[model samples]
Target: MKVQVKSFFSVLSGGKPVVRTLDLQEGTTAEDAMKLMKVDFSDGAIILINGRPSNEKSVLSEGDFFVVMPPVSAA
Candidate 1:
């Protein structure tokens, strides 16, 4: 199964799209995908799977899209 991953910051930068297609086996979780990317999300970061808030253990499926965003604040 192939899953799509994207980062919010990359989209804001207008840089090369952060979207990536990965071939994962069955029963892969969000944490598993993060590990594959070697990303250690900060405590203040928010994770969304297919537009809904999700956690590390959330399971993923083919064609699933994830968006990772850091907490934003205003002074």
Candidate 2:
């Protein structure tokens, strides 16, 4: 299955966020995908599937869009 994964670390990053197309297993979960993508969401992140709220365990589908938005803070 092919899924699109995107992460927004901070708006101040000047739109350098990463968007990747992952060719994952059929039953791959959102969390697993993040790990495979090497995203540092250890502190926590707002996860969404196709623009809707989702959890780590959510099973992904073909052509699904997964987004990871971490809490923004003043650096």
Per-model TM values vs. the true structure: 0.74, 0.82
lDDT of 1 by residue, 19-43 (tens): 7788999999988887775555655
Expressed as tens digits, the lDDT of each residue in 1-75 for candidate 2 is 999998776443676778899999999999999898776766778899999999888999999999988866799
TM-score for candidate 1: 0.74
List the candidate 2 regions with Cα displacement exceeding 4 Å.
10-15, 73-75
Cα distance off (Å), candidate 2, residue 19: 0.7
**Top candidate by lDDT:** 2
Worst 10 residues of 1 by lDDT: 8-17
Q: List the residue pairs that clash in candidate 1.
A: none
Model 2: which ten-residue window has the lowest total lDDT? 7-16
**TM-score computed on alpha carbons, candidate 2:** 0.82
